[model samples]
Target: MDMWLHTANGQVNLRVSRQLYTVQSEYQTIEIFESPEYGRLLVLDGDVIFSRSDEFIYNEMVVHVPMAVHPHVKKVLIIGGGDGGVARELTAYADIEEIHIVEPDQVFVEACKTYFPETAQSFDDPRVQLIHRDGLRYLRGRQGEYDLIISDSTDPFGHTAGLFTKEFYGSCYRALREDGILVYQHGSPFFDEDETAFRSMHRKVYHSFPISRVYQAHIPTCPSGYWMFGFASKQYHPVTDCNPQRWQARNIKTWYYTTNLHRGAFMLPKYVEDLLKEAEAK
Candidate 1:
């Protein structure tokens, strides 16, 4: 069967060349497929996690948006993203001291190391500590432990259903040091099925954080062409407190995320803004 993602109206399918790896991981079905359009694709529980070609767009925005605004980020906690692509982007900054990636399925992580070695190679870095455990559990008892936290998790269902609740975002808030930021892709605003859940998810995150904002990116492999990321912080305002010049000075090379685009990312469309307003009101 050709790899496909279901949309609100219909579905999108990619031309798959062959299967690279397929396994039944403890937590989910792990599969890697070679596609003519997107190159190597990672699928967990039949969901498109990331594709090599467009991963830079997703990884860069989710990492650098907070990295640019928050002046100094020394340690980071990444929930999911066992593929190591997320950590790979963070390692570009010399100031990042510790990068922790927690994945529930050890088998999926191993598959990334073998098939996506270039991205997964971040695990070999001295700074990254790959934790084989549930991220929600990992965040428990972690108070003021990290400068930043990135939830690179899959959509809320099956294996990750627990992550979308109010308690989990509160856990994320407590896990971060003062001035820390949390960024995670919250799904698309365009899809009919996702719009309600996205608003609710935004509401839950807003409840946990004093400053909660949503941003957009075009991720082709995702369920919809449009995707949103939540930017929640304890102190820093993603736009007002943002220090773009200081971040630009670091000269971290990136494909999609730039210091200039950081502000624009937070500039939501009118419809999206209305949704956020409605979410906040409810």
Candidate 2:
């Protein structure tokens, strides 16, 4: 018999085989399951955060796009990326000297370290610093410090909803250096509810940063399989400042992100374009 796990809204049922590990942390429920289709699966609060088979797509896009655009990114900060996938990608680059992660849940980190060793290996890097604290509060005093800040957080709900607020974005803006960039998971723009949140987030981030834009990535396991990421910068535009030659010189080979795709991701669909316009109107 096959096991099934329903994702957000319980609208889709993902097939599973054996339960590997389960933990009820103070923050949320974390589960690891072996799925024949997706390989190792990581679940938090009943939401499928990532499946090993396709995680490269989401993780690579989220990390590489902004990094490729920024000429020199040395200091990086990640908020709420408990799975360590984001940190794993950042550490792969030798140019990044320090990586500070502010994740509130230690249980989630241990769960990832135990079950998803490949992704969790990020913790082994000497450059990575994992801090157990709320990401919002962690950024309170750090101003003009990080060259890049990536919020690889959960969807906006429960305790994470604050991450989407104008106040949190303001903090992120202040935490970044003058030429630094901010990248984060901006939910999906395909559904009504998700699009509403996306538009609101874009509006709030726009107010905080001088330049901001939304980009797309395809994640088969996420809601609707079409995900969005936000790029906000004080000095660089995602496409204009992106140096394909410079990134290629680093010899970083990625599964989903390419310099060509980085240029193309910012091309929004009609509906998404209209949504941004509508948000601006309000």
Name the regions of candidate 2 deviating beyond 4 angstroms. Answer: none
Model 2 — which ten-residue stretch has the worst lDDT?
5-14
- In candidate 2 the C-alpha lDDT for residue 178 amounts to 96
Instruction: Give the TM-scores of the predictions, in the order they appear.
Output: 0.95, 0.97
Best by TM-score: 2
* Deviation (Å) of 74 in candidate 2: 0.8
Candidate 1 Cα errors over 4 Å, as ranges: 1-10
Q: How many clashes (backbone N, Cα, C below 3 Å) per candidate?
A: 0, 0
After the best TM-score superposition of candidate 2, give how far the Cα of residue 63 lies from its true spot, in angstroms.
1.2
TM for candidate 1 is 0.95
Give the alpha carbon lDDT tens digit for every residue of 200-234 in model 2: 98889877888888999888888888888899999
lDDT of 1 by residue, 195-268 (tens): 89989999999888999999888889877677899999999988898887898899999878876678788888
lDDT of each: 0.87, 0.89
